[model samples]
Target: MDFKDYYETLGLERGATQDEVKRAYRKLARKFHPDVNKEPGAEEKFKEAGEAYEVLKDPEKRAAYDQLGANWQAGQDFRAPPDWNDGFEFSGGGYTEANEEDFSDFFETLFGRARAQGARQQSSRQFHAHGQDHYARITIDLKDAYEGATRTISLQAPEVDASGHVTLKTRSIRVNIPKGVTEGKHIRLAGQGTPGIGQGKPGDLYLEINFRDDGHYTAEGRDVYFDLPITPWEAAMGGKVKAPTPNGVVELKIPQNAHAGQKLRLKGRGIPGKSAGDLYAVLQIAVPPAKTDEDRKLYEQMARQMKFDPRAKLGV
Candidate 1:
């Protein structure tokens, strides 16, 4: 795939407003469309404009491209640096904003195939096409994945207006997050995407699931892992301890003399699945500080009564 300057293609500055980009694309598309104009390069020019409009028109793709900086020239030798998109919020949704398979190589390099986009656009062209399908991604608590949830999302769609002009409109709608849905998987919403042109039907919408960052645990596949803080005595004399899970708090028994970082597993406590993963509690021992006289006396007594030497292995 080649490189493209979406900003320049639309004849807009890098900082152009979403509205500005959309307006530019509408004007150019209408002007250069082969159906509307017979110029020799009309089709090619229209495609180039569409490709640019596709990226700049979306808030997500725009942000990702913006981070590439406004310094690189259009058509310049470009390759994604190792750290490119290091901190951007790409859903890896990886769909072209333009509907057709008519995008430039530059577009495909960054994002994968525009297959879905093409399908929707082409389907829209059918004489009685139904509504096109839309796609989105959202993050929620692992609990949301465990137990179904209801969430409201805001959608901004780039659409063709009554005058055959391209424009964007914003709307919000509520959706259900089904239980046991995993990351990178999609949830479909009937009649949610772009409305069909003519007497065509409306398209469906699909949303991919992602987990929000949690302080208590990190999820992988179907498993959940968490660090459990414990006192020194608990490590030396392990017993039942309280642990947190998506469902609720639960008691986990640990073996006596359990070492720090020892893992305790609770079967079927993780994500819901046929062979559900277990929840792991990795113990982190907390040493008491010598802030009180009693604490200092206990340490002094231990030092006097024990011959423990941490540096003995170093022959110090």
Candidate 2:
């Protein structure tokens, strides 16, 4: 994809302030508006100005774009960096602020398809008195993300009774947990939320995902990390040590002279799918106590044989 310099399109510097961007967009919009300027390519120029302003106007989109770095020139070939917006939050309601049809393919690739078609369809209706939307949280084990599972979530809300009086209601609904769902992701249940008023449709339920506190491994997005404990001998002499991953236990080679907290990457062993995440093994050395006389003698003999001072770097 060729990079589009939004700042250049608006005749402003890269560090232009918000007010400057707005002013430039307004001036360019007026100059190229098809109705005002009947010149050739005026309509295309007007569309270009709108696209530039569309991205620069939104703070979230602007920040994401700025992450591409400043070295890129206009019309330079570009590909989005891996996991560019990994933890960034966008709306789960499938509604976007921008008109999805107007933006170019580059915009869609950077920012996902905005403006859900269903949302547009719903807006054309004349129904008034819509139902109130509901939100709830659901937590599951990390394994549930690897292998999909069904979870029941309970929700409490106030609903109108037959007597025209509001009453508290508690209900439990079974939700299917899909594989590869990470933390902070949501599951939308349409028409399963609060009941509608009059002839209006029921609102949808948004269930936010949370992982249980499992001490075995730590997860960041799709990547997983676990500590691999090994003896000093294993660290000094590179050996294969069995390490635990989300999938199963696998032999991980400890590099010679491996120090504590040293990491080794197991590519594509994390959350399953295309573009899967990598699993990291952090090395931790565990020393055995010299309790027995034989053990003490062996440790003393090694101490006398080896003239190693760990604090030599500290000048102690």
Candidate 3:
């Protein structure tokens, strides 16, 4: 879908403050109110102004919007980046009466569903005790935990309609990633759940954060470990070698006489977090094959001359 310039929609700059956004929205809403304006599509424009205000007014929503950046022109093709929803949250199946079809793909893609019209009425219908809470699991990356990121997750929920028939609704929501939010910690979004019945509040929506596994990065607790195999010569000779981490590859110094399975620690190089974590490089000694006659002769000569017998302890 083409991107909508929310700032432009309200005739504000990309860096417009929340108060500026709120003021702009009010001016536009008054100027374009369907009831006050005779121009065609005034209602549509007014609605757009309202939607933009909703996002730009709230700190959480505004932060999420700012993440999208001002580089995207209005009507530009848009796609969410890896960790777009860093610190906001949503619960209900994306669209509701309060902010239904009036919202844009950009808004919906960035935030949670708005309260539907007559949500109050729906709640009054009362389904006995508060309905059971809903559950959703959102997959985040290990780096997200390292440095607390935001994410917009898509979810589909099953619910029964007024006719007692079950239906599925899809919603995409944004949630803040708290520091050290390890796998399985539920991020709860209040008032963003299914409506309750007869004096019962709506059920809550719980988001469980899960980390996506990386082939190169093995994340355990606050520590990261990687195995790097080097030629026996590199282990024996003190030198700088390239080592990989979640951030990227960096030069690591291996001291002379470093042994196989020796571990080197790089402080504060793991995932991003408050206390952060460390990166460890474990050495694996690689033995080259004696494929050439010269290579075979060298091993044979060393074996014959060296006084260091590996079996010296086991006299036979």
Candidate 4:
């Protein structure tokens, strides 16, 4: 799909405020209205301005568009990012009507079906109801919870079409998962849900948060846990060993005679937040297998040299 720069269409910079966008749309509409200007392409320009307003004037659409980033040029071949709206919750409430023939393909690509249906419903009905709120769960990376990240989420919901029939439609949007968000928490995106019936206000979208389960790490509350595998020599020699934490790896000093299943705590190294949680590394000592003669000889020598009897207490 070829992308359209709605900001460019209105002769405004990407940073234009809502008021600036509204003002620009009005000015452009008046200057290029076919009935007033009658200039070549004036009608096209007018429709373009309206389409731009249709997106920029709404916060949710504007945000979704902005997530595509600012580097795209107008008319550039574009494809919607996969899972672009994965974590976002969008409610539908505000919409402006335009003839399907007036808007370009790009406009329809973004807001065509919903806007057309809402407009048609508004004209046909006197009573209106608020749009329905939508909810979904999104699974994020553990690292994202530590440092924050943006995710694309796809949502399938029932949408009313121009024929007055409801059909399930899939849409995508991008959302920012804030730092330190834990599982079961929610992110809210206002006006990114189902469009209201008639002239009613749109409902909000709520996204439940879930974190990916990583093999190396497990989290409970803000605390993070990991298993630290070490050699038998390293466990008994009292040396510094590199331990893995969510933030990164750090040298952990193992005391002489450190036992299996012992936990070592690194303060404030877990999930980041006020009163941050700790990272716990549980130690597991692994003994080398005696495969070669030399290794077996060493084991025998140790068995004879050291007074060790692990099963002595079992009275075997």
TM-score of each: 0.62, 0.56, 0.49, 0.55
Misplaced by over 4 Å in model 4 are 1-129, 158-168
What is candidate 4's TM-score against the reference? 0.55
Q: How do all the candidates rank in terms of TM-score, highest first?
A: 1, 2, 4, 3
Report the lDDT tens digits of candidate 2 across residue range 202-299.
Answer: 76677778777678787789888888889999999999988877778898888899999999999987766567778899888999999899999989
TM-score of 2: 0.56
Per-residue C-alpha lDDT of model 3 across residues 159-190, encoded as one tens digit per residue:
33564333445678778887666666788777
Instruction: State the RMSD for candidate 3.
Output: 15.8
Candidate 1 per-residue lDDT over residues 85-151, each given as its tens digit: 4323332133544555796666666654234454545554555556556655566678888888898
Give lDDT per model, in order. 0.71, 0.72, 0.69, 0.76
lDDT score, candidate 2, position 217: 81
Q: What is the lDDT of residue 94 in candidate 1?
A: 34
Name the lDDT of candidate 4: 0.76
lDDT of candidate 2 vs native? 0.72
- Residue runs of model 1 more than 4 Å from their true location after superposition: 1-54, 57-60, 63-131, 158-168, 197-201, 303-316
Candidate 2 local Cα displacement, residue 262, angstroms: 1.0
Which candidate should be chosen as best, given TM-score against the real structure? 1
